[model samples]
Target: MSEKAMTDIRNDPAAATRHDIALSIDKVRGVLEALRFGSITLTVHDARVVQIDVTEKTRLHA
Candidate 1:
């Protein structure tokens, strides 16, 4: 992320209100596409996602 982008996210109150659902969804989408073998967990409270957890696994071939 660029410094300008970081500043923009911080400066725009609407972009960050309630943990920024749009941004969270975009991030989740990206993670979903990139992950092959992993678990995506969303921690929510009051119908809002508060945290995201990504656990990736490595499989060894015999």
Candidate 2:
């Protein structure tokens, strides 16, 4: 998502709804999985996503 788009969503009052927050979390998880990430931690404050921590595993090639 573009920075402006994200900013728009974050600034939207409807984005704080439980359904919207859940959808956002699911989307983030899907992106991480698609990128083969090891784990992701989402920090939510005031029902908004404040921070995200992603751990990616590096594959070793012989």
Task: Name the top TM-score candidate.
Answer: 1
The global Cα lDDT (0 to 1) of model 1 is 0.82
Model 1 Cα shift for residue 15 (angstroms):
11
Tens-place lDDT per residue, model 2, 1-62, is: 67876777788767537557787778797767677737778888977777777788888889
Candidate 1: misplaced stretches above 4 Å? 1-19
Task: Give per-model TM-scores.
Answer: 0.61, 0.48
Query: Which residue pairs overlap in candidate 1's backbone?
Result: none
The TM-score obtained by model 1 is 0.61
| lDDT over C-alpha atoms for residue 44 of model 1 | 84
Report the lDDT of model 1 for residue 58: 90
For residues 1-62, what per-residue lDDT tens digits would candidate 1 score against the true structure?
A: 78886787799876556347877798899989999997999998866677989999999899
